[model samples]
Target: MVIRTKFMFRAGVTVLALSFSAPALTHPHVFAEARLDVNTDSNGNVASLHHVWRFDDLFSSTVLVEFDKNQDLALDQSELEEVGNVVHASLADFNYFQLVTHDGKDVPMQAPERLIADFVDNQLIILFESAPDSPLPLSGKVEFGVYDPTFYTAIDFVEDSYMTVNNLPAGCSSSVVRPDPDEALAQNQQSLTDAFFNDPTGNDMSKIFATRLELTCSKDS
Candidate 1:
């Protein structure tokens, strides 16, 4: 039996269709560039994370086709809102593709109240904010990254400027750490075996390749 969720039926079709033109072993069907802003509270704790994700042209074209109800060849404000809602709802199953860790422990995030979508230059841009279930202190190490565990969507923090920290304390610092893909694959050989290949979504193998933002704070401050 073939099971397709609303998201798979709508967006996955475009990905699968596009995949045929690429190398057979190519994993990701869709591509996106992401920007993140980490907001801090007065007490030097993480308050929220704001995200801006822009989809590739091919995927954006499919979205336009699906949501441009009036066939106007342009996405109006209402149409954009619908797109945002659909994308936001669809991401719930994947925890919004958010990965946050503090001292090697996963940090739980609360869903954002809104996801704003805009169509620009034939691309789809989505903006949203998510907050940790509780305030995350900045004294220890914190890592943040975004990836699709299913390996269907490749989200890239293409440049160092893609990530920012807001209202940060005096002694806090942040840096972007991009993993060497070849090195990561070599190190995780055993974990990335056939079982992972068969059901990529069942595990977080994508983390090995995800570009991360590392935040650190001095104990004195």
Candidate 2:
């Protein structure tokens, strides 16, 4: 589904239209400070992934003006809900910018629900939860990462402490793995060009820079 809200529709896809003459640029135009929480059941089965994304002030200002329909320079709850609906619908095709793996196999995720949106300090904060296609047991290993595959939006986990596991069985532990691109990719960062970002339809270079979260359960647990 395409972005439906006046604010997110523009911010989601047209971020580069401000400075770039070409809309085809694949590099990131909008940026987000992200936080992810992995929730598990008492028996150590994966429950859901709760995400909080804070849009940078540049794009947040745009959302504020467009979504604040009251002309009061403030966004009310109803206005925020409208933005949430649009974002929830728009991101389905993008896998909500997330990838999951269970025991070395890909884990599909269904569309997220319970979306909440709010504007604060010239920034837009979005809250949502995504569930796996099937029940995932915290067994040998469960890994996942959050990123914009198209490289159209840059999403970064700002705080290490915020990425945590909750309600898991004893002996289960989790950690966030920061990305470290290879020297070739590092030295050529900006020079890599759109081809690197474009990659092939089946593969994306952005995943190389994605921040991974890993959960491991002790065999005894």
Candidate 3:
């Protein structure tokens, strides 16, 4: 099933700068540029959809999962085997060590190279790529709810941090704050608002410094 959602916010500034002690991280910021597009059908009822997702991780996975088999059922040796009989380079036979190392899979890296997870629409999307190989920012599909962990969990085996309410700037509109600890994420959507654009220049971003951000995590991890 294809999950349809719109991730409520985006960063205006580079966030990687937040983690000073965490060396495993390099690109901590999230950037997205959506091409607002309109689709026309037989009756001329204009439908709008942004070919959205400045997902550096998602973009790269596409390159990998492109090797998938089973008619898009999943990515595995069977997919790679389609191109060859021996199937030397397949998902199952992949070297996780190499994948993690290449993708910076730790403090430096947030998500795994390959993943499949339950989205807000509660659907699983097969991630086929990693980060952007080119200089340009990466992007993909458009989402509709607010759940970094929900989206990140599939690709990221472990969640270190994300766009959280604790760090939210001013001008952000929502029921509350977002990108908080996993346990605390199960609250009202009001914690997160539909105000932030893909740009980092959110209206309420300054709140990060002013607010006490109600978060739930070990103070000293």
Assess each prediction's global lDDT (C-alpha) against the native.
0.78, 0.71, 0.24
Best by lDDT: 1
- Write candidate 3's Cα lDDT for 1-221 as tens digits: 01112222235421111111111212223322212122222322212211222234453344234344335545455443332222112223222111111111211112234333212221212322222122211111111111121111112212122222222122222231224544333453354444332322223221222111122222121
Query: lDDT value for candidate 1?
Result: 0.78
Task: Put down candidate 1 lDDT per residue, 59-167, tens digits, no spaces.
Answer: 8888888778789999999989887877777677667888899987889899989899999899989999999999789877889988777666788888898988887
Per TM-score, what order, best first?
1, 2, 3
| Stronger candidate by TM-score (1 vs 2) | 1
Task: Give the Cα-based TM-score of candidate 3 against the true structure.
Answer: 0.18
- Answer with 2 or 3, whichever has the higher lDDT: 2
Model 2 Cα lDDT, one tens digit per residue, 1-221: 01112222453543211221112345666788888888887766779999888888877877777667777988898888877776766676668778688776778898876578988787899888888888888888888778765665778887787677787677777788886668547865776666554452234455657788888877666
Off by over 4 Å in 1: 1-26
Error of 3 at 49 (Å): 3.8
Residue 177 lDDT (model 2): 84
> Clashing residue pairs, candidate 2?
none
lDDT of 2 at 47: 90
Candidate 2, residue 15: Cα displacement in angstroms equals 14
Comparing candidate 1 with candidate 3, which one achieves the higher TM-score?
1
Lowest lDDT block of 10, candidate 1: 15-24
The TM-score of predicted model 1 comes to 0.85
lDDT of 2 at 114: 55
- The segments of candidate 3 whose C-alpha lies over 4 angstroms from its true place after superposition are 1-33, 41-44, 47-221
